[model samples]
Target: MLSIKNLTKIYGGKNKAVDDISLDIEQGEFIAFIGTSGSGKTTALRMINRMIEPTSGSIEIDGKDVMQMNPVELRRSIGYVIQQIGLLPHLTIKENIVLVPKLLKWSEERKDKKARELINLVDLPESYLDRYPNELSGGQQQRIGVIRALAAEQDIILMDEPFGALDPITRDTLQDLVKVLQKKLGKTFIFVTHDMDEAIKLADRIAILSNGQLIQFDTPDEILRNPANQFVRDFIGENRLIQDRPNMRTVEDAMIKPISVTADKSLSEVISIMRERRVDTIFVTRNDGTLLGYLDIEDINEGYRKGKDLVDIMHRDLFKIQIHDKLQDSVRTILKRNLRNIPVVDENNILLGLITRSNLVDIVYDSIWGETPAGVDEA
Candidate 1:
């Protein structure tokens, strides 16, 4: 277990980057530090690894003070992964992964054996072992960055926005990879990210920070259902406030007006509408505006170039939530479908708006408990 008490970090003059934050994270827990810029989430994360010193506080791992150990020795035992994916461009994948074990004078056979084992664990081909970092894609490199952190067999790992730069598909893929590794290995993870959806999806509990103070630390479900203040609610975005309506508002209240096109539309027309709207998915409809399905660009990109019609390549699975249905009622269907956005329909089964994963994230976080977050702005 990791215990932090009265953790504080003050910079030049009187600026406190992290102020009196205290938390107790159980072993094998996956916790996230999330907030807007300069909320001290990153500061708090950095301090745990001693990359940034704390002005006043105590951090203990397994009942031992982290400060009492040698800095070099302490770091070697704690895995760290960052957004930049700081792999040495010149080093082979195997060599990069075993940096710490090499420092500890591990035998050549042992290092190679462990390296190959982890490579397989992440489902990477054995051929990747001899490849240089430059030879891999951004997603592949980030995967290497993550596995390298675990290469040393550290029970605790700290990741700071590790997937922040990847494309949405790659980011989602990596998040699933990390969650699988976290559960299979039973490792303790303190992840830092500004994306609330990422936090809600991965963390067992979230540690919300603002102005360097630990505002609220609880399960993802609780934080969304009951924010401590306006800042928390605002950071969660405007949709978080919808839970407090007297009738417990439905997806209709939070859904966005959708931009859609007919299935018969040419691929060019579909692409044009999507480009103009800057949207990832476009709903397909019939002449009467009846819902058809939706198109995922990736699933049909090649087909689109072959002059295939939108109807030919578009997804046929019709997943939607009714406008009158309470928000919580759709949580299971939304997440179970792993959809980016779902079509919202009215009583007549006419498309209304799009209920996106980004919007549904907050609602799902609290829906299980049927509690609304605090601080609903009555404007």
Candidate 2:
């Protein structure tokens, strides 16, 4: 267990960066420190490993005072990850991972075994051990940075906006990976970020700070349902959490059965289905319901006039979303691709259902109002 009591940090002789903050984090809990800039979130995190000295108070890990321990040994015992990653460009990926182990005088054989194990934890291949950091992509490098922190086998991990520099897609992927790893390894993590959504998504409890004071610290569900004060309510809008939670579902969870036809169907048959279904586009699938592509009415008519079949007119370029993909990501793809609807496919490319604009609107309406969208009668 980590116990923080009246921890205070003052800089420039008088400015209290962290003013007498206190928190108790259970072992194996994922805690997030989130707030506006200058709210001392990072200061509070840095204080854990003695990266930033506090003016007063105490931090104890497993009932032992942190101040009494040697700073170097204390730091090495705790895993730390930062936004910049700070991986040495000259070092091989293996060298970077085993640096802490080498300092601890671990045998080369054990180090090699540990390196490969940690590498596999992040889904990286053993082949990456021989490559330089520059050879990896941004996401791969960030993954390396994460596993490197865990490479030391520390009980506690401190992350200071580690995914802040990544793009939305890469960041979300890393966030999911980290969450899975945290649960699997049962490591205690104190993550500091300015994003409340990230906090709510990843944290079991959030410590919201403001003006160097701890504003409110609570679980995501509690914080969303009951904001402590006006400051918190404004900082994290009441409806923000509601809007985000329902939208995080998978495509399979949110999709609806869409109008579809097999690719072998005639153009006249495709046009008839489109007219009957009141849709301008028809999903083209194989006889086995595996998505082949789509057909627009205009294309179908052109094909029919030219005596062409559905297979000749169907557009295979339609953007398809995986059933396992996050609904939020599906929404983004829809907007980015300017798509009217997206076909949801399984791992085997078999069509399951689709996410339409109406489906997204219904989800939003239900999330905000806590009810189904009103029809013309209700409206």
Stretches of candidate 2 exceeding 4 Å from the true structure? 238-255, 258-355, 366-379
Candidate 1 lDDT tens digits, 1-379: 8999999999996999999999999999999999888989998998888998889999999999988888888899999999999999888999998988888899999999989998888889989999999999999989989989998899999999999999877887799789989999999999999988788778999999989999889987677778889888888766544533312567778788899897778888887888899987788889888898888767557777687877788877776778886565465446645767888898777898888888776454545444545544222
Q: Rate the local accuracy (lDDT) of all candidates.
A: 0.84, 0.87
- Candidate 1: worst-modelled 10 consecutive residues by lDDT: 239-248
Off by over 4 Å in 1: 240-379
Model 1, position 219: C-alpha lDDT score: 86
The residue pairs that clash in candidate 2, if any, are: none
